[model samples]
Target: MTLPGITPYDGKTLPQSKAVSATNVHEARTALGNRLRELRQLAGQTGKQLAESLSWQPSKVSKIENGKQTPSAEDIKDWTRITNSTSQATALLASLRTLETQHAEWQRILKGGIRPRQNALAELDQKTRLFRVFEATVIPGLLQTSEYARARFAESIRVFKLANDINEAVEARLKRQDIFYRSDKRFHFVLTEAALRFRLCSPEVMLGQLDRLMSLSALPNVKLGIIGFETQYTASPWHGFWLYDDDKVLVETFSAGLNLAQPQEIALYATVFEELASVASYGRSARGIINRVIADLSPDDAEA
Candidate 1:
């Protein structure tokens, strides 16, 4: 998301919002890095001296200085303190605020087309070794069959008045499942019983999706759990979230997707996932819940 420009502590205005695109974030980041280094030099402190004072590894300092990593507000404050230019703290914070609020609006992301977005997800899927997911409403993308996924994409496109990229987007999303066969990766999915009955697809398609879950649950690296309505729970399923390992959490809200990366935010999501997982049924019990949903749709269908 593009943020408005904020005045730095020095009174010179920097349009950090202009730096929000994928191309410019780097340049803006590098600019901040340069300013940080210049401050250190002005303090007559060497790289090693500053690293020692901050009690950080030399590599950590080097990464932020080279724009290989983004520095936290605390890191910026410490850097300014060491330089005795505590005033620079405000300017650095202004830049940091823009850097932190990187919300990619759905319109902007899908404006290019959904196929590209699917390709982007494929890249991230390949890198993630562990995927922890919880969905209370719609079916998680990774678990959706091509038919189910196509229906979903078609509805979304119509709602958003987007381009007709459903065919290519579904093809791209299916490729993401290639990671499913890799023995090196692991997946944990916790879905509420209501998700299976969401009515996003026809009875046949939803049944097929439930069958897919049953089969995927048996995989050695995949742990699929279903939380039944009968299960007691203290927390509300406010939003669906996917934790990509422990590094990040992707939350789907009504307005937009939230990308949470701060350590505290990640920890909070971890706790929520763990708590929800505790109330979920796994293996045969999980399949039973899915089977019941299918049976409710079609009394003769027992194929789950």
Candidate 2:
């Protein structure tokens, strides 16, 4: 659903209502990366210098700063030593350990085995003022139907070797959709054309998913846009990212999710979102695309 500028937070509270929310592994990693970068800069250390001090390669420092790699606690301690901020380094090391504790593969949440992960997401869905989602390959979880979610989650479980709790996981996912219907919040989604047509489950299941997309696009508070595969974007084909207001960002990769908390990086993600929105189809044109996808599914219903 597309939420207009109107937010539950009054104009006065909008500034203060901004929050920092990292509901998953990707988000935490992003946040940690931002912190590391900030501490490095505050200490007036260059990436090359930091790497030399840490006895690691410069590329590794760059990857950590860009949220490309999940930094180990040892790496973080070294980063702090290079920056000459012993106290700050220790604090961040603790946070990183907390993030990595017990759960190593965050993708497991989708597959049905990570119950805590699923619940953490639900809790975030309860309070977020805005959800800015750009999906490169499939529907955002907030908008996914139970069938599609089950298929996606089940596949994740098998592929990742996570626990098989598809039934409970699917139920949690469906319940998570309540945020869309709530009058107090807003959800906006920017989907790649490939994602619009990506059939994760059966033809019937995809149809249901598309139909739901159409329905969600019509909501006054929901804004759904599709980026055609052929069209050029100002920020073309960036990795899938979910920006939750000014508080956090979830950057997805093949191996892990990066949670970003630093204000600068979150701002960067928001800027990218704006650029993506600028190039995407909206309103009537966007609705027409959704309708066309739905129409294409009608004939295949019998086959399913």
Q: Write down the TM-score of every candidate.
A: 0.67, 0.67
lDDT of 2 by residue, 91-130 (tens): 7877777676422446644444655566888887776889
Off by over 4 Å in 1: 1-101, 299-304
Model 2 C-alpha RMSD vs. true structure (Å) is 9.4
C-alpha local distance difference test of each model: 0.80, 0.74
**Model 2 TM-score relative to the real fold:** 0.67
Predicted candidate 1 versus true structure: per-residue lDDT over 3-77, tens digit per residue: 334223222322232221233455566878889999999999988999999999988888888888879899999
The parts of candidate 2 lying over 4 Å away from their true place are 1-95, 98-104, 107-112, 300-304
The clash number for model 1 is 1
